[model samples]
Target: MRHSRILADVGAALRFYSRIPVPAGAAEDAFAPPNLKRIAYAVPLAGAVIGLAGAAILIGAHALGLPNLVAAILAVLTCVLLTGALHEDGLADTADGFGGGASRLRRLEIMRDSRIGSYGACALVFSLLLRVALLDGLLALSPTRAALALIAAASLSRAAGMLLLEFLPPARADGASAAAGQPGADAAVRSALVGALLATLLIVPSTGVGATLMAIGLSVLALFAMTRLSNRLIGGQTGDVAGAVQQLCEIAFLMGVLIYARPH
Candidate 1:
């Protein structure tokens, strides 16, 4: 019973940050957990739910003989629904911050503004286009493989987000990232290893061990590049940097799939 209550409280925290509304009195203490250990687990669990929804949409679209374009739209829409567009907004804000500002303070100020900028617009478009294109390509493979890939990508990308939080300092004194900064390095490392193991198990059986290795390697490279960029741009990382990492890692995984997955 106590465990259930804790999980509910954690769920409320997740919903709160993700901008999804929960019922009143469901769980009031936002920081009751006071540690991000559960959050590390929660993130991938949420991703799994979102990924399952996306897989269902893809499978349904395919059965209906829907065009790749339509399937892509549905898949993206599913993500939007599940995450409430939280990460997308983060990506846009990060883009505006990095692309428009001359100094760290200016960039941080830009990111805080509600108005979207040209850089944000371009980043959103590119990110969506990349996701859609890669998903469409994946769907061309066997349905089972596509479904597994969706789940793996969603889960692992979120795990990547948690990884950034573990190693990087909060760029801002008070922001979403700071609030999520309760996970210790050990917990983050364990979650990351678990996520990687799950991804490897899922992808290797379907796409071959070679493809799985390639995907994991590319994801690592993407993570390194993103972390370096975050340090250069903001002196460390914020929640936005975590979002950017997830987005880039997802792209890297897709690119790996394209390079390795045999054409149908």
Candidate 2:
């Protein structure tokens, strides 16, 4: 691909996945909705950039003598802010829809509602708690390793979420996912490959090849489970489902890495 096309794809991925403002001059139609079909393969690159931003906050907080837990929270908070809690909102909505609705249609409606239900609230709390705890534990081992883990998890989770776009039809005729369109198998495969390469390179030096492979395997398993549950519950994929799966895979990846990582 030409450099301009590659840059456009990267910009589109960041525009869709983050709150960061791309320069208007980058493209004539910069304000147009991102084309996910071409952009999906570049999503992992956007994720790695976001991870770098979060890692900066994390390392800076730790360097200032903040507690590891506090540093982790701040780092996560930075990521949430950068992404406008985009994935977290999806996770909350998915939890509410799946837990409270009676049918596929009703579930989609529940997910679209802006109001937070008990199920949504509980899901958000638990997700945040687990992420913070996992990051804290990793930080306790080594700040550098923890930073790299954040990058790997971010990139891999987004890549895993692409499986839904590749394998499942959209549940609704209208919505962000439907509007953006499903990514082609080629784009999805490229995404997975890029995410895996970035994750392996970042994780192996600190966690070793065995732990990195284990983490990747567990992440794939989590992705598969989420894919099955979403299909069963909603009849297809949605933007919310994608977000929820990404969150789940990230947690699974962290758990796998933390279980095997040792202090160096």
Which parts of model 2 are misplaced by more than 4 Å? 24-28
CA RMSD of each candidate after superposition: 2.8, 1.3
Q: What digit string (tens of lDDT, one per residue) describes model 2 on residues 1-264?
A: 898877777777887799999764434566666666777778988888888898899999999999999999999999999999999999999999999999989999999999999999999999999988999999999999889989889899999888777889999999988887888898889999989999999999889987798889999998888789889989899999899988888888887789889997
Best by lDDT: 2
The collision pairs in model 1 are: none
lDDT at position 109, candidate 2: 96
Error of 2 at 30 (Å): 3.2
lDDT of each: 0.76, 0.88
Clashes of each: 0, 0
- Candidate 1 segments whose C-alpha is farther than 4 A from its true place: 1-34
TM-score of 1: 0.89
Residue range 1-264, candidate 1, lDDT tens digits: 287764564465456444445453543564443356655655665565567788889888978999876787798778777777778888899999999989999999998887899999898899889888888887777767777777778777877888888777889988878865747887788668766877888898888877787877888888888888888988888887788788788778767766788854
